[model samples]
Target: MKGFIEDTNYSIGLLDDTATPRDVIDNYIYEHTLMGKNAFFVADLGKIVKKHFKWKNIMGRVNPFYTVRCNSSPAVLEILAALSMGFACANKNEMSLVYDLGIPMENAVYTNPCKQASQIKHAAKIGVNLMTCDSETELKKIARNHFNAKLLLHIATEGISGEEDMNMTFGTTLKNCRHLLECAKELSVEVVGVKFHVSSSNNPQTYIHALSDARCVFDMAEELGFKMNILDIGGISENEAQLEELYQAVSPLLDVYFPEGSGTRIIAEPGSFYVSSAFTLAVNVMAKNVIEHDQHLPSAGKQISNKPAFIYCMNEGVYGSFARKLSEKLNTAPEVHKKYKDDEPLFASSLLGPSYDELDVIVEHCLLPELEVGDWVVFENMGCGSLNEQSPFADFEKPSLYNFMSFSDWYEIQDTGNTSESLMKSLCVPCFHLGEDQFCTV
Candidate 1:
């Protein structure tokens, strides 16, 4: 792992034991041509493992079902599977992917309330009976396709009150909970639990409120003769501080509502919190153009206060791995790997992707040092909702993913005089080809 990566043709590897992240990026750039490609410096599976352990330490009572929709890298999934993490799937393909990894269907929950008929049938055929439904239409669909499926009623919580709120699109309201339970009873669909999401950016109060609503639904379901055994506290925060706040607010309420020995199972579907910081995307600066105010028509006649702007066209953009910027409204800033002079001043720059569409622009205005054509701009926290959104637009090949570990059992054995043979036998690098386009190295 310290020298050249042996298995792949890409000969990039760590320069030394103390190799910095920039050193790894520089080494890769030295080995390969970035002609028209982006790269992902995936922080090894150990980061994910650490995150999982931390989550378990903090929220020990709550079971985490890793959301596969966040980052479905086969290597990521394999590492999580090896650690025995349950999966929260959104569709048939995700279910199949998890099943292909040898994960039992019992450890998975179909969280999507709105599912296709074919997907329902497929889940039933494969014995994945744990699913969710929010409306009568969805419940009817589930009853028709898989009546024996254990169901969770997705209740719409009062999400964050802002333009970014997405509560209206999914989940059943508290007012409709009884009606939904009655419909499930009439259709013979077993309602086993209640699930609710406070959206991505809601405060801890949102979780508390959602939990209170779920408790009401639970009592109602029990009254209706439905065994309410599961309580799904859906995904909310991406950082430990926020999650701790949520736990502090919801833990006590859980005791009051679905208490210990109450025969209720507590689970959560955390996506970005697990893998968001474990990946870094490095985009090559393909071309650059300095734009003076006088050169542009819009600012030609006006007296601009700032310096001349630089436009950098990179290989990947909003249409590619940066789709989260446009889709999830993420604000991405660039980190230049090259060093700058002490006296050199930074200029406002606009970063554009390799696409012809105007919406492909990544960063609108950010002060950066004047960069060369081959320089690299790195973006951290790229593991969320990327990769899977990548497309072959403009005939550009997808970026090659290189996974490197910072900690491993092999490191401890190095001090004990273990031979390379023994190290190779013990080391597990979970690399596999997911498809013709995706290649992962762990």
Candidate 2:
């Protein structure tokens, strides 16, 4: 094991300072073929830290609790944890993961409104009391199971015009907010805050309307004799520009309704905005085929044009890390990395996953230079809501993941000499194998 480790270490040290992420990925693929059945992931931990700082600088008034459901890779968790970011967990497992990393329970918010009875009990037993509830039934369950729990009443918001809406499934309606608060008061449950999600839409009005709804809830909670001190503005952006828009729209409202020094702690649960651009996936091309479409002109009685389309099948598919395409309507395009002849014309092409299901197709009708088997196709913006949702299908194993960060960043985290070294130890680059079947940490 020592020799093998040393060999891997030597290989990594050989990389030049000018190496691009693609260079690291290409080298890793060439070295660890694993029978040509591996998919590689390059995570930029420094980028995640930079994003956290950027968020803090822009929305300094709002603390961020990273949604763990998006890219729950250990590397992602470690980086966020090192930054002292709180967590927004949807289930027991996510909470446990955070706890296992030695993060305090107070730093985690159980965001699922509808939870199992056992889950609520377990959270209480583990000292995680900050939870969200949207219904009277959930309030009753919490009251019976853990009366000391700190609660957030989740309010439903209007659907944004041009974005994915989540108002249908979760959130309590405004008409029912008063009644829910009354029930919480009667049960002696501590309803300390209001929470709402704008569903990652670009509409700035969604935040305005949602904030207005949250203010109404706050007013009702105050009337019900509860001290409302926390406001959870849920994730509502896909990029920094949209996040700034949301912040700009809601900043004035927060000032008006919940002024500074009012002791109202404002926090947000941003998942995609933090991790969407921090990961790059490199999938190996396993097979290829060319289909020629011939057009025959009736007057000429001969085929005048032959349009050949190339189809390249890779080892990872929709059932694996690319599942977001099917589940979340993600439209991802592939960038082919191959040495092309200047005269070689680009052709229409399709990329497919190595699955029997026809729905495993990744991208269709895209133009790319000619590629052969064993080549590589790279996809960016793959860090959000991926990897953790993957499954091994048709007896095919999941791809192995390799996390990366700049050497300077790794050394700084080490030099800071914080107790978080235990977590940072696992995030050190040069590959942490995160296959579905096996887990390895550096």
Candidate 3:
């Protein structure tokens, strides 16, 4: 009630240029500790704005299609849409979200290699005919469900030394690209381009091989009388520095293969690259149990008195903000919220969810200070695929999001000339407790 109006889905807390996300998280944790120990999220939207500008400065030639499956927080989508970035939706729900945002249909691509038949019809109905396909079955399904579809032949890249499993998953092989093109021609489906994803190995040689494979696919499409124009270099690197290295490695090849005036438009699907470092998650310890560890001595049995093992039940777990933990993907360590001396005793700890399910473990093993029932724990770099999951059990709900931005970053957004004050008004309300600026809903 002290923040934005009840109708506003999210409110932006304006911080001065010197302030950081830690200040916002600290404020929230202090308030929630007194009221109710609820788990929540604090997003520094300034990092997202900076990331977008960095992408433009570093990889200006390649258009980025924001992958929705990574993190579909409404405020994130609104901010990216305001900046005029295109979208890569994995399914009908994501496509519908983009469509509802009033973005042009041409700016959205259905990138799911295996899609439902009904989702294909929905794409056709919305005039988002640009999509990617890797198999004859999916190609024929699109041909039948959406006649106007223009397809991108997804080619598999040669894996780096340790990324063969990641590279072998979805894309069609080079030998089969010709057969897929033939099948598309027979079905009268337009094969307009090629797409391939190199995993996050950050190797320039891998991208070199992928670009070479893409060029071969383009040649094959040309042999079948298809004028290929789009080249989606699939997902990108984790950060702008790595992206710059990649661009430097591949720019020469791009010019040699498909130079200027070739009419080929380059694009990439980047999800974690945009949102991974922008948000932080804070969870509360709802329950704690201390288990004693026994050690056998030479003369008598003794227990380890210095360190005790603890099992903590957190309000948010794999079913919620830490869903990536289910796959053992995110091994982030949580910081104890209280101020403790460096010499304070550390104990072995394992964190679990509020659910009764045995698989709801969030952190398997870690070292942390002693925490009580209502203490706080914070996880940083949680922006990728973290904010959207909701608990299936009746005991918990989705974590609330508190979005913020520095005034300097806001000014930079205005300087972009694409984002206006009115666009900000449409995206979020203002938290009066944080700043004097008032953003009335439009």
Cα deviation at 419, candidate 3, in Å, is 3.7
lDDT of each: 0.74, 0.75, 0.81
The lDDT-based order of candidates, best leading, equals: 3, 2, 1
- Candidate 1: pairs in clash: none
Let me know the TM-score candidate 1 reaches against the reference structure: 0.84
Could you say which candidate leads in TM-score?
Answer: 3
Per-residue lDDT tens digits of candidate 3, residues 1-442?
A: 1322112355566775444566678787877777687788878888888899889888868899999888887668877887788999999989988887778988888999899999999999988999999999999899999999999999888866655454668899998999999999899999999998887776899899889989999999999999999999988876678899999999999998878679999999999889988888899999998886333121133334666678899999888788888774673678988899999877777889998479988877767888999899999889887776878877676677777787787777677666634356743544323332232232
Query: Which tens-of-lDDT digit does each residue in 26-58 have in candidate 1?
Result: 555544442334454544445676787789888
What lDDT score is found at residue 58 in candidate 1? 82
For model 3 the TM-score comes to 0.89
- lDDT for residue 370 in candidate 2, whole number 0-100: 80
Model 1: weakest 10-residue lDDT segment is 4-13
* Per-residue C-alpha lDDT of model 2 across residues 1-442, encoded as one tens digit per residue: 1112101121122122555566656656665465554676666666786787789888869999999888677667777887788999999888887887788888999988789889888889888899999888888889989867999999888875655554768888998999988888788889899998876555778788888888898888888799999999887575787778778888999899888878899999988878888788888888998777342112234332455667888888888878888866664568776667777776667788888578987875566788888888889888887677555675565555665666666665555454365554443334433231222333
**Model 2: which residue pairs collide?**
none
